[model samples]
Target: MAIIIAGWIDLDVEDVTDIIASAKAHIDGAYTENGCIHYIWTKDVFVPGRIHVYEEWSETADLQYHFDNHWYKDMGGHLRQFPRKGSQIRKFRVDLIEPVYDPSGTPRADFFTAK
Candidate 1:
């Protein structure tokens, strides 16, 4: 099963843009790292100053390296500015995922025959 990580963050007005920018930059820079299948950052549409992070890693070592090097080691000061109000991080294995069709490709009901 793949690893899934979700985190919620609330930021002060001053740090809102900075927090989002940093997260975007980090993901863009790190997505090709050994175990990173997905690293998406999202802002809460309805809630002001709220951010959500989603990560999928190949293994525990890959995730540990990311936290230790990217967030904890390199971004300590930058991350400290964000408020921890009611924030939480959760981790789990993915049991299943629905497949998505590639619309740009030829339209075939069967994925294998699409090409």
Candidate 2:
């Protein structure tokens, strides 16, 4: 089973591009590390001031290393200087994570709506 680290950030309703860029950079660095399968960031289009981050790792220890790494520790400080309202973090094991198929036996055309 893989591990998933999910999180959300509420920016200060100001300029969010910078904070988001920083987060992407951090995730990019983490993705280059061992055991990292995926790292991505997204915004809630319906919610004006929302940011979501998802990380997938091959093992629990690798995910733990990410939390203990310098990027994780420094992100809070950097976001604080920006217009961040709050943040949340959660980690869980992925018992199953696979592609959803269409009725015709092809992969789902819409990634977001696949599940």
C-alpha TM-scores of all predictions: 0.68, 0.75
Residue 69's lDDT within candidate 2 is 88
Write the residue-wise lDDT of candidate 2 on 2-95 in tens digits.
9888998888784466567767667677877778998877777777778888888999888778888876766656667766677897888877
Evaluated with lDDT, which candidate comes out highest?
2
The regions of model 2 sitting more than 4 angstroms off are 102-115
What is candidate 2's CA lDDT for residue 84? 64
Error at 101, model 1, angstroms: 10
Candidate 1 lDDT tens digits, 28-72: 766867798988777787777777878899888888888767544
- How much is 30 displaced in model 2, in angstroms? 0.9
